[model samples]
Target: MITAVSELVKYYSSFVDAELLKAYLAGSRSEERDPMEHIEAGVQWICQAQDAFECGGVARSYSMIYQPYFRKSGWFAPYPETTGYIIPTLIDYARLVNSQELVDRALRMADWECRVQMPSGAVQGGMIDQASSPAIFNTGQVIFGWIRAFHETGEPAYLASAIKAGKFLVSQQDEDGAWRKSLSDFTMNSRMSSYTYNTRTAWGLMELARVTGDEEFEEAAIRNVEFALGQQLENGWFRSNCLNDPSQPLLHTIAYCIRGIMEIGALMKNQEYIARARRAADSVLARLRQDGSLAGRFNERWEPAVSWRCLTGEAQMAGIWGRLYQITGQPDYLKGLRRTNAALRKVQFLRTDQPGLYGGISGSEPIHGMYGRFEILNWAVKFFLDAQMLELSLMKKSDIRLQSNGLGDVASAN
Candidate 1:
């Protein structure tokens, strides 16, 4: 029978394997040819992910088929409205590349100041935006993205939207500091086998903490983490995952969840959250291999079915490993980082050289997400840059400094 959170390790192992980390440990899966190739490929992929989104901020998707046909593009381009997702991604890309165009795109999407605000004033757009009112989760995502853009570029356009979004989110929290289910529909569309609105709601709060230095955001984020912790299965796993995009639980979302908790742990200087992270890390590492590739999906029997690997599984895992290294100072995390990144390099799918053009991602892998396959490819650019720049930055900051100093000293002595 499944035991306590720690003992029910078998169920939780899927999260670890979600990123295909086995390949990292194997080490022979990918060649370390040109590092720039990976970076370039990542940039190309991100551009493609952006292209998938049509005008009016609609994702240009179909019915259950979920195929985002490029030929069907521009359908929504003329629409004056926008969605929540397109904005955050634009902001993230803006920060990573220091691109003004991305920042501009996000701001332009937010053109309607307070008019789009629901009674709660949160910014939201997604598949649901087409029908039901704005969702808290989607609003939070866009708000979080706009806040990042503000923090990165200091554009007031983004900040105005963020302030409304952040305050609205803070106000929406239940008395316990956690957000309730849905407010716009069915008092919050209560379909979750496990509570994720509160779990998923942490991003806007956490981002506010990072940008505003506000304790409320930090406190609110911890409350959601606490609520999510309460929802952990008997085997220490979370279910009732994303009903919106129901395929698999991504390591990135898991990482974000852990990060919210970790941030709270850091803010309060609490070790329990750190302990919690270590637990999750071990749970994930349990299924990881040296080659950096992880088993995509697992059966109820706890055996990994290799047929499930996808682009998202790797990028998200790479992020988690990097953060693990940050928290623990373990080189093993870096090895995981290198392996997963290499594997992603080998297969950067679903993107053309230039975005805003004819680009298509094959609608097969993870057939449930047919067109959205390239979504993860967009994330690879952001994470791959981290893998390269992490060590590169250190080398630049200290080693490069010392070498320059040494040369100056030698020249002076001569």
Candidate 2:
């Protein structure tokens, strides 16, 4: 603690003005007063980030500019894990807006992923070229992209790669449905242990099964989901979940687990699994601040472990809530969707002049929290774009329902 304090005292002033730094250091929780809804602005921000990604070599994420701490500038290598799932978002948006550039960009990303696939069919953890070792989570994330590409263009290569990845994941799974090998070092616990959040792996595998008519993949995915469900506490909190820290699990991982379960439930037509996801979602909803942000970490009982907000988690959870609303037609889920998505828009830097700040979402609120401090994460923007897309899609569907009932205004339909 003393070393941490000394480091903070030494470099805090170098990063920001004293007042802002002081507020962060003091752990202030002041909310934005005049938050507004700006979906178009958000979409424009997404475009800017995409341009920046291309400037950064279309690998994955960029560091924006030089950091006083690292003293480096320009874009870094593309991240394999996030670059995988980002494909679907890019393709969907491209279709929605008729942007050929984005479609081309998504293709490039998908092609890059195919080039980097290991002989074992698993993508490595961390940034590009970090390691040759395969990681289960990273492989699943990339598989999601490969399958999406196959669906978009009927490219046999994309399908072949996805099939290879799915086979690797299935081979790695233990008889109990837990992945015992190929876990990433990103977790704080022992590297050999399995993860609750690999419910995402199950979801991705399910996608592979659906596209390829592979019953083995489907059965493997179901087993993995069954294993993940065993980790959920009666209170709906997931154990052994976090990218970096498990003692105080990040909302990001919690959201991952919840979304994966919810998706599996939807795909399998299992109301019981959906109810499990709703239980966890309600636990999170109870903790959301009036400003639509959540604490970055939480204890097993669903209490806040930190004052800072994980912006990525907020966006992911918003998407989950939107999905829930679609399934159940619940008004509260709609309210949560609007409030959380609006909060995200409030934080987006809409100025097109600065490519890095515009459309890029920070990893943490106040921009100096424990996770991804001072850096904009690629997955952050990907999930934010996803949440916004879901929100808009739901709103449009709601509008259509209202119109069919002879009500022009959303308010009247409510």
Candidate 3:
């Protein structure tokens, strides 16, 4: 079967002849949004982030790219984790939207990261007037993007870039088995405050280690994880945010923690991480209903507060369920996954008006559409092409692996 990346390549090259292109060229409504427009929209935000180098390393977060931007009641520029997580989405979008131009632009951003890395083994999420800074959360997501760029192209340049980010993360670990300002700084330092930050970053670390077999990467992942575990609440659930900040216990942030920890758990063979993930999954599942939906954010008391579009939460929860099923071979997880996917399908992210091969729907409904299932667009493409890729793994048997990541297929010359 053909891989998702191949489909993406076809998507990218078709843009010139795409109806959207004609519309844009003709100044008509017949023009759909360019996939690169989407990618560029994303990348443009990256340029505004803590590390805006203009290299096109748009490790975009919806926060970065949202035009006519208005801040959330409690949100700010560049969601920390998405900055890293958007790497693959942008790269794939770049590839499918014209691989050479977009991917090279993405590579330029990745290149900037390699050059400006801090000695503290810390990386910046976005640029602060072109200054050096770092955060475990931002570093993780950025590393993830850089690594995915490498994976898509197999270019030494991308790989080298990823290694640089990975090495910085590895060096940032603290002695108390956490990667924070200090071991005692768990109060507001925990990533639990930010949905998907910990998980994406952790997942990124594992990705780098898995591909490169770098012991340091692995060790840093382990240590950073142990630190996160230390921050877990008594009943399960990661704690993040300032003690003064009344808003806490976000479902989106928790999902990131869950995915990163669970993926790392399986990869590291850490039963504890696995068990913890299961418990969190169970916690989430318990809260989930027969209708396949979840509340947005919660408090320490498990009280639902102001709920909004939690697209990332739903999508990652599906991914987490898929991972759980893969690791334990549990049908329950699959059922849970069906629920998540069902809910996800109802969301409006599938702007199926395929104006271009690689163009994606602008998600607005059940999903706010950034960094969550957006990443899964590739997974879905691959899954659609190869149904077997969706099968769960059995702990007693082999791991579930999708052969094609939907990022690098070539199109036939027209």
Local accuracy by lDDT, each model: 0.48, 0.73, 0.50
The estimated TM-scores of all candidates read 0.66, 0.85, 0.61
* Candidate 2 lDDT over residue span 1-414, tens digit each: 986666666565445443334334532222333222343443454455456554322434444334444444344466888888888877777776778887777888888888888899888877764656789988988888888788778999999999999999999999999987888654436632777888888889988888989999999988987888898889988877776666678888898888888887877888888999999999998887898888999999888999888999998888878777777778888789778988887666543344555456677887878766755677887788778777666766753322232211211110
Q: Return the top candidate by lDDT.
A: 2
RMSD in angstroms between candidate 3 and the native structure over all alpha carbons: 12.2
List the candidate 3 regions with Cα displacement exceeding 4 Å: 1-55, 59-83, 89-121, 127-132, 182-200, 241-247, 349-414
Query: lDDT of model 3 at residue 262?
Result: 77
Among all windows of 10 consecutive residues in model 1, the one with the lowest summed lDDT is: 405-414
Model 2 bad stretches (over 4 Å): 1-60, 64-74, 185-192, 399-414
lDDT of 3 by residue, 236-353 (tens): 6666622233355556567767777877876678899889878778777777767676666656655655455354455566666766665676778777776655554343222333
Between prediction 1 and prediction 3, which has the larger TM-score? 1
Superposed Cα deviation of residue 59, candidate 1 (Å): 4.6
